[model samples]
Target: MLRSCCFRCFGRRNGDGLLWHMDLKPHASGDFSIAVVQANSSLEDQSQVFTSPSATYVGVYDGHGGPEASRFVNRHLFPYLHKFSKEQGGLSPDVIKKAFNATEEDFTRLVKRSMPVKPQIASVGSCCLVGAISDGELYVANLGDSRAVLGRRGFDGEKSLVAERLSTDHNVSCENVRKEVEALHPDDSHIVVYCRGVWRIKGIIQVSRSIGDVYLKKPEFHRDPVFQQYGNFVPMKRPVLTAEPSIVTRKLIPQDLFLIFASDGLWEHLSDEAAVQIVSKYPRAGIAKRLVAAALQEAAKKREVRYKDIKKIERGIRRHFHDDITVVVIYLDHHKSSSKPNHKQGTAGCITPPVDIFSYNSDEAVENSGDKIFPNEESRSRVAY
Candidate 1:
């Protein structure tokens, strides 16, 4: 049972305030499972989970900004998803989309309430990429640039990777983003010039979509007002205020082998085929840790960090890496049997209501069981071994 593999490796760098963490907890009925991975940057790449009984196989979250945002999401987001699913009935793509939006709203509200006086903290935000598997179906939701790619084993004994982008970036360079920004700052040519060519809003921020950044969602700033006048009502712009992720769903065929969820930091340095090749060579858990180690090693090598300079070693490591790197490799094995009836060979099943594996009373049993499963720092520190 893979049960989900999550490890956070920090590079030796100044201002490397990235965080990566994950959690995998069995459902109340002990039949299904949920997993989450959060990372602040590419250097702090995260990993996914593959559990047994094969109920609900995978769920992942890739985070950006500083470590706080990623850490906060890693701790809070999955719980909200569970709660939302319980209330909404099952984990359809629609249910997952609703949960993602609600979670982001709640997270933003919570951050605003907690940091009422600190305006700087309001600017801090992170990108999110999520994937959820329920009742043999896969649902993906994304915010920012982190990606989820599925690799399926083919009949000819070959494997091909299929990438389905679930979220849209909020950067001003996007056509829709450009149109929106132009509406706001019609008079500001510099903003348009900076955003158009470099794909940055103010010449610094690369991503247009993310969590947090309440400050950027304000009116009288950007180009057009963040809040638009809707007749007698003023409505907040979708990109600025809403974290509702774009959702995509697909049936899980037996040939589906694995998935890779990684931040842009890692993807920027490595291609999709190269990344999948690295993970496909190993088993699930081993591949997860190896991917993190490989990213760190690559960052270190690129920065030219000298092995002899003990004092500057961390600095060297950090110099080569400005952002956190998180990678999650989810190994999907369909050979195992599930409680559901099998479809004919080569034919994937149609999307139907998700099967309920747990009854109402199962919640009480889950609570009473009191099984805790997350790695402590000491255990995670040994990742290099």
Candidate 2:
């Protein structure tokens, strides 16, 4: 059975408010920490870690426009990964891409089914970042701006750790991403325009690749009524967004210390180097929460308010100060003896935070929202001991 990391159960509340976290947990390679803070009416960020004796999987889904896409991905993406990996005999770039494509296709089908009742579903989308580790190899895949960063020991016998980016952000805020979008849609003079003080695709969205955003991808869903609720919708001859993910794979070495997987919310206030430094300087336990706290402090500073005051702010109002932030820190135990077992022997399972931070009954919500694993599949995967 999948384990729900509810505050009332294995996890703990960071404070009396919207922050919740898992201080530390053991994975196949080593330990991991997870933390999340809500800033949206409904939490738009969903994340999880699945571990086994042979492999580990990590994902952070940062939703926009609505939480539906992220939540959907949080539920289905891993299972698809497991299914395809099993069929393909092992994990590979092709397997990861196939799983992504399958998830995108399935979500589009879901939107089609829900359109009659919920036309707004077409506009919801999520940034996806995934990291898989197997046999001392790491694979990072991403869409939109969520990031996976490696904190590695310095080269040339230096003592400090270095921050190495593992995923490419696909948001149009970057000049290169803007150029890529423009090159793809040269016919559309306004493919990307400066709006609301930042660059946005078609003046509506920022990310050029994501799991959802059907209205921008399918012409049939581009009518006025389809996007009437969301003004500033632009008509396009072709898809302005894609589900394709940029992927990177690397063989792990002793120099690789840890991995930081987080949504753009944390990256907005903290640089890759700063985040790695935090991880390098702090204790392993609660390190993810520490990162979240640091980012919140920076967010508060930007708004010229006290951190305590921001903590008192409610979710929707709090979003003005910061987006829903999620951070997962995975440590690689290179020092572990090679003869030792990869992971503790136990039933295979997964660990994920409560679906929504602000839910009145998080335990109940988590119980109802436990992940669905593929049928008859068994791999000794778990995040916590």
Candidate 3:
């Protein structure tokens, strides 16, 4: 019944920019479920999960500035992961690191190729978080603010679930991350700056590590036309930021009940403990959707608006409230023997298929008669939810 606990509402697909929460669906891992909710007019978050007999992989990619970096990672990261996975005859820490490095290296190549034609490409980047399970070990690697939290129960008559954060957040909002950036650039006192009540690198981007943002990582791209709002520009000899991910390895144990992997948007509204408690208390089926809904409600509360009113607002306009939220919850199977591996299931070599969750806003606009103008294609009459 846990796997069957999905939120269900029927609405056929359409070309409009709106997208409702996806109903929960299983991956190759029979125990896990994934769902996503898009809030941005142009969705910038991308995520995927793949399971094979030997391994399970989950990715949460959050794009900033634009969608190119996230989209590129969604298309290529897993393939590179699969390539190294097969080459090594299994998954390993080195393999995951290489996959990330290769993906970063490849995206830089893309930025170089496009910079001449589209100067804006230099600024786009994505925060990368990947979770891999193999050979009884769980490997979590992250480059940005996305997080992975484990819900664990004690085997020694413990009745409650405990939240264990697995991924390291690289956002400047964390004091340690700011220290890390400052350590990297000892000579540059202004490397990490505090501005508008938030810490940022050079008073610009918040995350200290990421996959793209060639403009910040590579000195050559900085001279090009950057976003005007992010002025006071200074060039550096070495990269201002990095693509290296902080990876942690743990032996997967039976006590581990489930894992919550989500973008920062969800965390902006919900804490790790709050999320784990929800999963522990609720049926597993549509929990990801539930988490997303919770985040939206929190966002609405902060804006002092009714949830129903927020729901009625269109995508582009919704940006002022919240961000694109993506969540994947994987419940570990207790019935299976913890000592054994799932080798018999075969290599889960297939990268989850790419999804076009983001739609560009069309130039055409709709006028609300005696009201505000909006997109006419957003026909509320046709959507059931």
Candidate 4:
């Protein structure tokens, strides 16, 4: 049996700007399930939920620059992915790849039209990872560094985290990425200078694959200069840097445990294995909250702040850990119980109404939408007595 929960918590440093949300539901004759967790640096993260008798669609976009790009994908990606899938008549590997590429192009165009004032939103981009699971098949499309790792239960009943690496990191340091960068700066000794050889233009930005940031992709800006001093050397055209992402897919089995979709900040402090160990020990809904708490605690420890004064220690923590942190945990099994059931089913009755479960939305239609149906929301919101 397997059980799951979708829980999230935003640290104080992120202010009210951080947006985190998750949607999970059963699909394909209840043989498969779909879950999506999205987090952003601003409260502008948006998502669309579509439910079909046979499948559920979910996509997450972590926006940068401003919340608009993230919000745009959240609102549009799933619909487009579904359309692409339908056109292909199924969720084949080729369809998934085309959908990702098409979505990226669509997203780029939409953003440009939506925000005519490029400078106001200039340099803003986003890391997007889209996953569609249907009939034991999982299709993933990604841009930027936001990642998805699969966790599985071993023979011993212990969980193991395996990074299937659905997407490639788009930064400039990769051989292909370096070539792209060098194409732009052929005359420069350093191709996108950084702290050490360890950092290149590709690695420095951290997110190798992404949408937007037209400034970085401009040939004139990133291409190396072609020097022809004193008419001694022949002139040549330099190459330009690029930040294109890769698409990946795999067949899933019941043995596949869970997945962690998160930003680099949370991953910075923990490994996939460490994250699995921690979440496997607790219920799924509490995983994200606990992960955030752990990260804050780790940040606090680094600053030597007393537990009692953790609130007052924000400045110190921010100084050492500046990036906004976000985490989304998706458990594969839906039947596993984290604790014993209590007789009291709240003041209402044995059946917990959908409205009572997800109080986040006021609209009844929004609540009943199959995409927002999360069995763990109500139970996870309460503090264990």
Per-candidate Cα lDDT values, in order, are 0.47, 0.83, 0.73, 0.47
* Per-candidate count of clashing residue pairs (backbone under 3 Å): 25, 4, 3, 20
TM-score order of candidates, top first: 2, 3, 4, 1
Candidate 4, residues 148-197, lDDT tens digits: the string is 67777554645354444455555554567656556656676654556665
* Model 1 global lDDT (CA atoms, 0 to 1): 0.47
**Model 4 stretches astray by more than 4 angstroms:** 1-53, 110-118, 155-167, 172-189, 196-204, 218-243, 306-322, 334-385
Candidate 2: minimum summed lDDT over ten consecutive residues — where?
A: 375-384
Minimal lDDT window, size 10, model 3: 365-374
Error of 4 at 127 (Å): 1.0
What does candidate 2's lDDT look like per residue over 1-385, in tens digits?
2233212234887463788899988777688999999999778898888877677889999999888899889878888888888899989999999989999999999888877767788889999999999878899999999999999978986657789999998988999999999999889989999999999997888899999998889887767464565444567889999999999999999889999999999999999999999999989999999999999999999999999899989878999999999999999987651445543623245787877666634424444543321111122111111
Best-matching candidate per TM-score: 2
Q: How large is the C-alpha RMSD of every model relative to the true structure? A: 11.1, 6.2, 7.5, 11.0
Q: TM-score of model 4 relative to the true fold?
A: 0.63
If scored against the real structure, what TM-score would every candidate get? Answer: 0.62, 0.91, 0.83, 0.63
List model 3 lDDT by residue over 1-385, tens digit each: 2112111222233322344344454333446655565666546787777766556788899999877888788767887887887899877888889999999999889878776556677788999999987766889999999999999985566646789999999998999888888888999988888898998888889998898988888776776554333433556767888998899999988778889999999999999999999888888766777787788789989999987677667766888888888888887775552434355444343333223333222222211210211123354323333
User: What TM-score quantifies how close candidate 2 is to the native fold?
Assistant: 0.91
Q: Tens-digit lDDT track for model 1 on 223-340?
A: 3222222111222343333365667788878767667776766665666666767766764434544565556556556667632232223321443353345555655555433433
Error of 1 at 168 (Å): 5.6
